[model samples]
Target: MTTRTDSDHDFLASARRTLDLEQQALAALAARLDASFEHACRLILACHGRVVVTGIGKSGHIARKLAATLASTGTPAFFVHAGEASHGDLGMVVESDLVLALSNSGETAEITALLPLFKRLGTRLIAMTGHSGSTLARHADAHLDVSVEREACPLDLAPTSSTTASLALGDALAIALLEARDFSPEEFALSHPGGTLGKRLLLKVADLMHTGAELPLVNHGTSLRDALIEMTRKGHGFTCIVDAEGRLSGIYTDGDLRRTIDHHGDVRRLTIDEVMTFGGLTIEADTLAAEAIRVMEQHRVTTLVVVDTEQRPQGILKMHDLLRSGIV
Candidate 1:
């Protein structure tokens, strides 16, 4: 029976050893990277159809993640279970497509069984395996050697260090392809529209601004009291003061009211034009909402009027809108 103190010490030592072994494996993988890595990248870049990533068990899990990373970064890819390919999933492979197979031993029976079929379909194969001379590697058009000196597992049987090496190599390949294609953040956002980065990159001012009846508008010559009513009615803390032609001439806000009270004792005798700041901070409707946030932060304001090409007020964007849309 081991004491709790002994067990804790053993656990910590084991964890440290495992991490050190895995880090060394990654370092070795990086040092040994040669033309084969470039060859793999070229195959993926030239692929006319989607890359089908396949493996079994733990390798299969890594394959799925690699496929997702590749897809999100600009390469088209999807995962298929190696064991199920012989049943019917192999039909997904086509002549123009490419196959990326992962197996630590490079002798996964289920994966090797599909090799002849992949070759028959005239699909290019890229193998990520620990065994360089294995049948899978021998048959591959490009072989990425993910061999590790030893597993992090105490028994050196579990797929610990080898799996980490394979995953890291897969990431390297995906990022290389991403740079080769010059994939942009906006393009990455298209695949992840529900995420925070997507909101920051894809959302435009037009998408989050209040328009039509929601806009708080008061003409330039309107009385200050009436403009206050409009501002309160819209609940955006400000109102757009426009000219007779409905073009934006200025804006009045809570700050302007404070300045007005200080400048003149009797506020009731004043019109909006007497207190409003002419053509204050404004942004185009086509501008990015992230850019709007930056402008507000730099100028220390809570709202901006959205204008069109003709300098007419189209809509209004408040900081609250950005907060609600998860852009802030």
Candidate 2:
């Protein structure tokens, strides 16, 4: 156990106050949306090339995240350091690009220095800053005002509330542009093929469905012992039973074999139809693999048969298929 100190209490109070101030700043930013924001959205929506984001210091980091969000949401974008623009990296900006310049004060020396060139190159400029009347804002094609009432920092010298408002403004632009472009989840998935979301959206049931010879299949008249042998041989712990017309009749699993043995006291003489769970345990082949996982979860079953419109067994899927797809 440790003793409490007045200094620690004061520190906690100050931190709480700082958080309150920053939260209020963000709230103000959210409530202050105007036509300029819409104008910025339209500018980005009409762009033929990428949205080039640039800022200095803390704003630069936020710019990088903004660029990433934009790119992920169907708006092509990348970040360029304002500090590098003066050193011939300015060549990266093309007439087709839309530039988003960030400066909390709207007067960062490095960023302000780039305005003349952006104008000369005919790049569409959108400014995110605290002061709409600042030089940077005045030179921009559209100015997004992100002014805050106060800084959360005790010294008022550090960028706290100002940066929060700017970052929120950046996200507002990214998402607004995202909505305007009608970016779909499938489009977003194409850019994120390695992440969990990518696996969920980009990958479909067909990509991982057990087709070909790996499918555990048997005729409707298969004996329980034979179905058990097929289930064991396939290692999917299940088998699909079909009729002479190739229509799916039922599915047999390890659990069904156990239950059948309990009911008949012998697997050798029992037919698979007597042991298989009926219509309740099947899913469509065209259904999303994620949906298949949910069906398995809801029924507490591992095996599912993918059937066509005629209720014919097309393929077999197991909990392991969903697991391998990273969708479970």
Clash count, candidate 1: 0
Give the lowest summed-lDDT range of ten residues in model 1.
1-10
Per-model clash counts, in order, read: 0, 0
Query: How well is each residue in 225-267 modelled by candidate 1, as lDDT tens digits?
Result: 9999999998888899888888899888888888899989899
* Alpha-carbon deviation at 79 in model 1, angstroms: 0.4
- lDDT of the candidates, in the order given: 0.93, 0.85
| TM-score of each candidate structure, all chains considered together | 0.93, 0.93
CA error at residue 304 for candidate 1, angstroms = 1.3
Determine the C-alpha RMSD for candidate 2 after optimal superposition of all C-alphas. Answer: 2.9
| lDDT for position 66 in model 2 | 89
Which portions of model 2 show Cα errors greater than 4 Å?
1-11
Q: What clash pairs does model 2 have?
A: none
Per lDDT, the best of the predicted structures is: 1
> What is candidate 2's TM-score against the reference?
0.93
Error of 2 at 268 (Å): 2.8
